[model samples]
Target: MSALLVAVLLVPALGAAVIALFPRGRDHAARVTGTIFAAVTLIPIAVLPFARDDGWTTYSATPTALRPWTEFDVSWVPALRLDFHLGVDGVSYPLVALTGLLTVLCCAYTIGKVPSGGQGRTLVALLLVLEAGILGTFLALDLILFFLFFEVVLLPMYAVIIGWGGDDRRRAARKFVLYTLFGSVLLLLGVITVAVNAGTGDLAQLTGGTGLSRSTQLAAFALFAVAFAVKAPLWPLHTWLPDAHTQAPTVGSVILAGVLLKMGTYGLIRIGVGVAPLGAEWAAPLLGILAVAAILAGSLICLRQTELKRLIAYSSVGHMGFVLLGIATLTATGLQAALLGNVAHGLITGLLFFLAGAIKDRAHTGELADLGGLRESAPRLAGLLGFAAIASLGLPGLAGFWGEAFAVVAAVERGGGLWLTLAVLAAIGGALTAAYFLRLLRKVTHGPTGSASVPAGIGGAEWFAWSPLAALTLAVGLAPTLVLAATSAPVRALTEALR
Candidate 1:
């Protein structure tokens, strides 16, 4: 089990190295190597559930202390109180699995459609590095270790955007780096303050806001929240996202929506809330207010967006708004809703980006005015786009529905006039979500195909890349318990600590 966890982190780094060393122009070899490594990384995450002594079926009943799939801890830099520690509980398992799944699909997509002007080998190498960084962040248990893994993703993602993105790639890349670096700086300061004051950086030891003084916790939480909010891109700070998404390539956009965004939310739960409950309590109301604002603002922005990718990017602000709202409620159900929403958003938004990219590839533009009626020329493509749009709009019995509904329920259950008011506003945001998506559907798919040449349907590579997300979206929607169950235990533990 230990070896497997280590391999999960190392394999991708090794793959990246191999791809980097591969001869230039050997796109096929690079793609094959990346795919194999990405797929291999999934093995540990896949077997994690079964590897437990109590088995996968018993996960929901397992106690928090006993539920981690594996744990690896070792002394590293005794001076700084850092350890080479890593583990995965139910809360992180699904996200780690999602990362593996999306990385593999992205690699598969690259095999057939390398971005123009991108060196295939270099692109594959950067993706592999990015994958390793994401996986490491989810698995790391020490604050310093987590920070290292978290920052590791920065440069490679910048490369992906700058080297392979669209006309305004440089500007977008610079903006992305600047925003994230500002957050990273704050995050590092918070981590250092917590570690120095607590006398240790081990997350296991610091769970539930233990050890740190309330003042220190408050200070640390404030810093971490700013860092994560920027990443969660909670409004105002979110200006970087639409530009980044608009300029990035299809695969880049998929990973950005699917996995990268989760890093911020996950950190909020794991670090901000978990390690600083009193501070979380202090900030919850303000967080809830900002969340509602983001929900309304993102929806309003989407209604006005002419470009497909930018609209989806703005919608993320709204979707993540629900996640943040759930967290702000500081209740078990709310946190579980946040966790479930995290995974669902990853799957649904990733698929939306894929479809959008395919459209751009065919039509050479993402403008709604330029797209016209896709359904008339390509029923299959139109059907998939409509399906993703409806799912994203929180349609009943879909993956998106459970999270938003539960968030509103959580807010109401919190039982205050402020929460009730927020709940009503959030519900309105839901309706607005439906309006914008329906509007998008009407503009892009329902009308007659414009002058641009329309492809017959989505291609083989697209299907291969898209099928898992499509299946997961339906599977989770029909039986949300599958994911909710996995999250229940950890969320219960975290929320209990807050109380």
Candidate 2:
């Protein structure tokens, strides 16, 4: 069990090193190496169901402790009481699995779908490194360990955008780094305050202690919430996402939307809510307000977007709005909504990015005006686009439905007049989501099938790349219990801590 946990962290890092060693001239070598690395790493994730889940065990360094899925901890910084600690319970496990799965898909997409740019090796290596960083962040049980892994992701992702991105790569990368660093400063301050006040940076220990004062919890939670909300790219702070998504390469966009955005919501659940229950309770109303604004604003904004990727980026704001809203409720159903939404959004939006990349690759432009009558010349591609679009719109039996439905349900059941009103607003946001997607489908996929302007259909590689996402969208929708059951126990435990 310990070895598996270590492998989960090490596999991608090792793969990144191997990819770096590939000769610069051999582009295919980097692709092959990345594919192998991601594929092999996924094997352990597949075995997660068979892995045992015992009662909680803590690997404590004098002050801090690490509690992982199957615990492992060792000393690193004695003076600071920080340790190299990692763990995952049912709550964190699905996300770790999702990260592993998406990394494989991104690697596959990168290997074939992306254009043969100059820095292919660097791109692949950065992706591998990015995967490792995200996995480590998900598994880290120690606050300092989690923070280190969380920040580690930013550099590799920045390299990916700048090295292989579209026209405004430099500007996009700079904006991304600047915003993230700003958030990081706040996050660091918050973590240190919690650590110093609680007398430990161990997540389990802090939650178990009646250590920090309520005012202190509120102050620290506020800093952590803002930093995470930036990552969630929650409403007003979401300015960077559209540009980043628009200019980024296909795989970059996929990973950004699919896995990276979830990091914010994950941290809010695990760190802010877990350690600072009273603060979470105090902030719930404000968080709900911001979440509603994001939902309405993001949905309405998408209605006007001509560029496909920008539209998807804005849609993410709407989706994440629901995620934050769920977190604000601080109920089992609310947390469940947040968790399931995280996974569902990952699949559906990842598919959208994959399709968007494919469209951009073939049609050479993502503007709606430039993309007409796709169903005619490229029926398969157009069909896939429609499929992804409906999924994004929260069609009843697709992955998208559960997140929106569960969020609204959780909000309605939460019984707060303000919370219920916000949830209802989110429900209207759902309709707006439907409107934009239907509009997208009507313009690009349903009109004038016989036009010569439409590009060709999906190729074999594209189908192979997209099928898993399409399938998972249906799988999770129909059998949400698979996700619900896995997440319920951990969410219950975390929410219990809040009371």
Candidate 3:
């Protein structure tokens, strides 16, 4: 199992190097190399089901700290007692899997979709490196190591946005990097403060609590939450997301939606809530208030957006609201809902972006007003878009339904009085979600053909790009237990820590 863990972290880097060395002009070769690497990378993850959960295996972790594939531990600043150590546990597994799955899917979808021109190899290499960072973020158990992986993703994504993105790419990329970097600085301060105060940077050590007072816990919690909220892009902090998504390439948007946003929620669970339970309890109401605000604000923005990609980006803000709201409840059910919501949103939104990219390809633009009468011309494309949009709207029996429903249920049950009021507000967010999606349907697929200029439906590249996500959406919706089962043990362990 340990060996498998090592491979999952290393294969992509190795493959990425190999891809970089190959001739840049060989587009077909690059595609084949990328796909092969992605498939090979999944081998270790596939073995995970067979590897028994060696629960809570302790180590005198090496100096690599929490950095994946390089487990290291050493006294960095001895006076502060911060040691470098890192490892993965049950809590981190689902997210790691999500990262790997999306990497492969995004790489597969990128082939022949983007222009086969300058720096294709470089783009593929950056994507692979980005995958490594995301995987490491999920797996890192050391604060310093985790921060490294957390910050590492910014560069690769900037390249993706500026190198391969749409008009105004430079501006969008700048906003994305600047907003996230500001948060990263706060994250660094919070992490260092915890290490300094706790006398250790180890997550395991912090989880047991270094006997910090309640007031101190609250302060640390505030710092951590601010950093994560920005990444989660909750409410007003979310302005960068739509612009980033609107300008990013298809594969970039897919990765952004699929795995990157989860980093914030993941950190909240691992750091803020895990290390500061009392603080979480203290701040739950405030966080819940912010979560509600995000839900309402995001849903309303989605309703107003005319661009397909921007609308989906706003929709992600609303979906992440449910995740944060679930966490704010501080109940077992709520936490589970947050976990379920994380994976569910990843799948549904990733699919949405894929479909939206296809629409843009055919229509030559993603503006709602510019796109009309595609159903007759492109039946398969229109049908898949409808299915994804419906799922996003939380249609019953679909993958998206349970997460929001469970979050609301948990909120109403655990939070009495004003808590219920907030939960009710969240329910209204759901209603708004449905409304905007319906609006999108009417404008993009159902209304009279807007213009003869709209291109006919999907082609080979588009179908290949979309079909897997479509299938996965239906499969997960039909039998959500597939993902739920993988998350159960981890969510259980995390909730137990709160108790």
* Candidate with maximal TM-score: 1
lDDT score of residue 461 within candidate 1: 77
lDDT (10s digit) by residue, model 3, range 118-217: 4666777788888888887876667887898899899999989999888898999999999999999989988887777776678766773455667777
RMSD of each: 2.0, 2.8, 3.7
lDDT of 1 by residue, 1-499 (tens): 6667788889889989888877876779888898899998888779876665334333343222223567778888877667899888888888999999999999989888899867877887888899999998988888999999999999999999999999999999999999999999999999999998988888877878878989998999999999999887888799999999999999999999999999999999998998888899999999999999999999999999999999999999999999999999999889989999999999999999999999999999989988988988878989999999999999888899999999999999999999999999999999999999999999899866676656876667789999999999999999999898777777877877876
Spell out the clash pairs found in candidate 2: 68-87, 68-88, 69-88, 376-449
Report, for every candidate in turn, its global Cα lDDT versus the true structure. 0.89, 0.84, 0.80
Output the TM-score of candidate 2: 0.95
Candidate 1 global CA lDDT score: 0.89
- Assess candidate 1 and give its TM-score to the true structure: 0.97
Per-prediction TM-score, please? Answer: 0.97, 0.95, 0.92
Candidate 3 regions with alpha-carbon error over 4 angstroms: 53-86, 452-461
C-alpha RMSD between model 1 and the true structure: 2.0
How does model 2 fare in lDDT?
0.84
Per-residue lDDT of candidate 2, residues 317-339 (tens digit): 99999898889888899999999
Clashes of 1: 2
